[model samples]
Target: MNQTSTECVRVDINVFPTAPPPPPPVVGPIPEKLLKIMRKYKYNWRLDQLSKPKHLEKKFIAEVVEPLKIVKVKLPKLDPEKEYYADQQSIPLIRWLVINKKLYGKQNGKKYRKTINRYINKGWGSIYNFYKKRERDRRLRQRKREAKKEKRMPDFERFTKLAIPKRLFKPQSPTKKSPAKIFSNFDRLDVLATPKPFVEEPVKRLGVNPAALTYEPTETVIRLAQIPARLKNLPKPLEPGKVQKSALRYKVTPRIETLAVPKQRNEKAKVDEDYDPWTIPPNVLKYKATPRILELAKPTERS
Candidate 1:
């Protein structure tokens, strides 16, 4: 028996519907009308329009409506339920706010929320407590080190008190000498010796001639007369000059004529041929002139 074959065709439909084209591209929280108002107003837009409530409605419209009418291009979408954390950018902003109070409200509210969340995660109370404990421990450690240093120092007064008593009170006193033994021998010698009685002899006068012995004068008495009267006196008179006429006559003569004969000219004395006064330099003859010659050569006319 020949049977006719019928081919079956399989149609595969994607169960997820291609994820609905990623729910269109999330356009913006800022709408066209809001953007126009923002452009007109510059930075003075209403806070409620820029807030979370308006952003949620705008996000829904962008997620649902924008891509369906277009070429169905998928773009990145932000989750409405999850928080957008900008902690990296917000930390410097928070630090700036803490340093400058004027920037406290001027910062973006979202950035402030992210910074507050980060600080909460890092535990602000724990950081403050750690610094406080560190300072306290440092002070305690410093005090303990100072106490130890003081304990190591010597107490000079206590050392002095212990030393003085040991040095002053250790030795015994020396024994005294016996006075009775030293004086016993001296007493016996004084009792044994007796003093002799003094004897009296008669003094007699003998007669002698007065001329039997001749008196002699001492040599020292004769030398007394030889001493000069001027030497005995404290001061003496000056003597008058006794001039010798012969000596005065001798000194008045020229020294060369009185003391020596004149030197005679010999055959060896020669006349100098070069002794021309005009040829001689004036400076060479300065010491050769007599005083009388110098006076005679003076100018007759006064200047």
Candidate 2:
């Protein structure tokens, strides 16, 4: 049996592969939503990855940076959960990349990363230099904007010149007026009589002498005097949105009554009124049994 053989023929066509749709123009103004996110994070680009060049190339280094702390933020828009724990001190760029990944996938995330990189690579050498220069440029831009706005505004002078009256311009003759009238009754006359000298006189009083009079404070006055002390002990108002700490509660214990006994003393023995403890022998002093030491030592040994 003869086997039929088939050979495939190669054909060449002049057709060229189309280029990708320009990568969606990465070099353009960042989205307002992204800028809002940056503002929330205070435009903090100080990240571990941003600090080192080796970390820049690593795709997963900036994936999940450890935050300074985790805080629960309230989100009213979400249906089920009212609040969610969010990372603090996290890089805004990383958050954008994450959001893009979840919403648009890896390609969009890469584009966002490139945009952030472009912004970061603006100034001379490092991220710090870039941020400094960016801040200076922003200040300069704000100043220029203010200057332009002032230039556009109409000149509103606070004190404007008033029009001179036509009557004042015309020459007028000076007129003479009669002298002011002087009344003899209105004249200030010097007092010819001098004031009488002060004289001491006997004061008449009803039975009680003025020197013996005393003042007694009323109940209201006493209460007013205690107001300052009462105010010091008053409970302070609780801070807004803060729970006041509960006051400590002490447990009450029953009091045990004990029979009182008279202290014992030897009357016959010649008691030394001047027994110098400092001059006593060292051995005796060291082993001396005092009431306080005996009382304290009672709890040491178990019966």
Candidate 3:
């Protein structure tokens, strides 16, 4: 037999174009002032790696530390009397700082976890308590406003009101002790005239009107009224033979036959009773889990 030989074949494919060269790193040496601030305020970690330049490849001096410097410079100028207000003002800045630190940690392969946690635990000061106080104050102001609105004066009365002065009354007057001689209402005054006899007026109503007594006809009554009172000719009675023929013509037809077989005596009644339309057939159905359905179908896992 001829000697068998194997040779490797080479193939080259330029399906994907070569990617462009990466931009040069914009990194610079960490400033002494930035390092000092970081040490003082505890802004970031990996200070030990400052001497080892490789670990400080992605220094977050501009993104993270610069804002802290600005805040430090402005802190003294802000009024200390409104300390809470100043703190509230710094909320957005602190939140942004924390978020940037987290992003930086992620960029450095999560090596600076303490930096993120420190900012979250230390830098974010009493934010939840501050919001709670604000909400409480808002509710109190709302209640005060509602009460003030309630206490507001109403519109002036339409009728003329006279303010009777106490000076108009005479002290220890004989007329004040005596009963009034004049009666304002004539109906209540006693007179020498005899009582008049009751007389019925023709214009005055004695009973309810006939039209008012009667109710308006309903739709059913109006529709029934349109029908003739009497028929010109009465309908003939149905014959027994014709009625029988009509019943036979309209009788329901027999059910169509089905090819389905009846259950055998050997088969269990549960087979037909438990049949679900939604269930997949056993022949083609698949269970893509460990221990199939037996373990999963249980209410609690086997001990």
Candidate 4:
């Protein structure tokens, strides 16, 4: 009533205040006795020297310390044939083709996909993951090599192999084999695909002997003479001579594996003795370093 027109002032209030964080929780002070004991022991406190260290328990050593101990475990031998990657350098098929002037002088996404797919059957998986795993393996190998190098004698030759030349990795042209040709399409027409008999054959049911279906026992226990007719289909007993001598059969011949083909397989045989068709093909590299007699007539000797 004194002001007749009283002005109302609106004040903006903040729900959350932005301020520096409160100090961290105060840790309880170390016991004066514990502090004195720690000071006496010093930083280099030898637990083993202690008569009865509280932390050094038998259970602690067995359960915790033993497992925590560092061990140099021997790695299993890796087979190059099994562990070897075809594309270790991680070169993309199209990229390789381009570099080598292959791919029929074409550069496109479709061609790239097709080229990549060609090597997929040969165990090419996700390129990204493959390279990642390869890098990880390479790092581990490097670490092992470094450790070995440190421990090795100065006079002894280190296992430092000569680096492979980039030219050696020249991508060989993919063989002129097509997927369509590899997997020939053909419908299976075999009627005996399933166990179901043909229209002409009788429907066979699996159960007790077929003879039992028609059997009609004349008495509670049939005479032993009738046993022969009842057990006609039963297997015959072994004869004295035909009986097995030992648990393991001696006549069995273990498989003899021939690793390499015959060296002189392709050599011309006498006219009387024709070449064996089933013989393994000759190795061209068998006489790689050795010189052979010339079959062609010499220029000087020829009339």
Candidate 5:
């Protein structure tokens, strides 16, 4: 009603209360028991003066910060064949989100999606590139090992030279003269001229009749009957006279008393006129009768 007269008066009405800045947003003191628990569990938390905070900042730090700090993270190994990635560069970012579960929430659920995005934007962009390079290097080493294994395989040429053919193992034939050539000189003449068959003829001195004896004719009798042409032409012996014996006995008879007289001894006596001349046969003189000389003689003269 007093301003009804249109008089301008500046009255400051504070929409947000400036009552001593709301007593500087009262900070609850950390309990000694909770601090001890945090010290024991938080492995990565800095206890240095530069990182320690005098008062907690609600905007920057969570109201009930988890006591545990993750010192290490373990990601599940990727099955490169199955996972769908935008490119090889996205591999490590995915690995980081999976492993650092505390940084991003448990199970990589929606609550931690924003944290993942923030890490990707920040200097963590090169993580995937580094992982891809390592994967490529490992694959190269594996390929090199496979190449070395192939090189070490046995060479076919080496084995082929060592292998021998079955035909080469056959035994060698003996070197000897043929049977036909050894008996070439044998003939029928050699068979016929061998030796006369020996025949045992019985003597009948007791005036026994020859017909009365049991007589067996031998091969010698048959062979002798077939006389050679050369021997058949030879002359027979002359017959002796019985009457000449009486005439000769009377003519040559000297008185026994006169013949008994001492005769002069001669060292070389000539001959008696009545003695017959000794004639040597031609075959007997030419033939070699000794057994040793016959054995060493030529084959034609052997028998």
Candidate 6:
């Protein structure tokens, strides 16, 4: 008897991905709500990547980064029958473990390392050169644009003079006034009397001003005929927004000197009659507390 056997062939297509496709970043403009936060962090960058710390791995953590889910660890079965700690056995931990995260994986680390090394080697200088190159390119582009604009423009003055309307350029005869009569009809302005200026009288809190007593009415000061003319001798009515020249002088009235007071002492010592401290008093008045009177009452101890 002949037996039939079937041979099976397994074709495993090894689809070793070149690199796992990067996650879609939640990139956006610095949101209006985040403007104050950006200013506080001094991260005033306009790029979409600068504000996305999770995907971009830029400087500090940003709001775009989502917090990791807490992991719960179950407690060991110390007492299986007890139900008191049943609900509380599994503890949820909210902590940041500094282990190798997805961000530090082999594929993403190369770029981060490259940038870090670049920054370490030359931080400010590289940024400066990049901006300088951009500015130079911008200036070159502007020059080219201006040159193109100039080439496109026609010579303005080369064209024929604009057709000016007759009403615009036509000259008209000016009205000439008749010659004035030279005879002295009105008094000459030069011959008019010059009115005296009203001088301001100094204000006194108590005594009346001496200059006000001899005051004369003038055109500059307002004259209130109803009241005594002497009362109007005060300073001229100031123009609405104008301040008096004296007001700007800031003269602090010298504070009146205070009256002198009798000398007083804060000690119980009485004022004794004058006596020379150097002169020795007679035996009756000699001080008893001298070195001889200060002898030690106890026997002196020897070291």
**In candidate 1, which residue ranges exceed 4 Å CA deviation?**
1-125, 158-303
Residue pairs of candidate 5 with colliding backbone atoms? none
List runs of model 3 lying over 4 Å from the truth.
1-78, 93-104, 109-112, 127-303
Query: What is residue 195's positional error in candidate 3, in angstroms?
Result: 99
Cα lDDT, model 3, residue 57: 67
Global lDDT for candidate 2? Answer: 0.58
Q: Which pairs in model 6 have colliding backbones?
A: none
Residue-by-residue lDDT tens digits, candidate 2, 1-303: 336876778999898886433323237789998667666764334532365675446355556767788788996565433222122122344445446556665555776667656544432333335576678789999999999998898556632333444455667789889899977753335443556689998777668876657767789989877858756887666565775445345433443222334334455333867654447567876797889988988855322
> What order do you get sorting by lDDT, best first?
5, 3, 1, 2, 6, 4
Cα-based lDDT at residue 84, candidate 1: 35
Clashes of 3: 0
What do the candidate models score in CA lDDT, each in turn?
0.59, 0.58, 0.61, 0.57, 0.64, 0.57
Estimate, for each residue in 208-283, the C-alpha lDDT of model 6 and write its tens digit: 7789989987864655446787676876554667887788996555452222343354344235545344566488
Among all candidates shown, the one with the greatest TM-score: 2
lDDT of 3 by residue, 96-191 (tens): 766777568676655476656665554445565567557767999999998888679543452224334345655865655677687577655556
Q: What is the number of backbone collisions in each predicted candidate, taken in the order shown?
A: 0, 0, 0, 0, 0, 0
Instruction: Score candidate 4 by TM-score against the native.
Output: 0.12
User: Candidates 2 and 3: which is better by lDDT?
Assistant: 3
Q: What C-alpha lDDT, on a 0 to 100 scale, does residue 146 get in candidate 2?
A: 94
- lDDT by residue (tens digit), candidate 5, 1-303: 675678677999869854221113227997898678566854323333446778987786658867888688788977775453434444345556646756547566975777666755442345445666678679999999999987998778877977856565668798887677455656767997899899998874767677767677789988887979998787655345545545667754478768878766353433555433365757989986788887777465321
TM-score of each: 0.12, 0.19, 0.15, 0.12, 0.12, 0.14
Give Cα distance to truth, residue 169, candidate 2, Å. Answer: 13
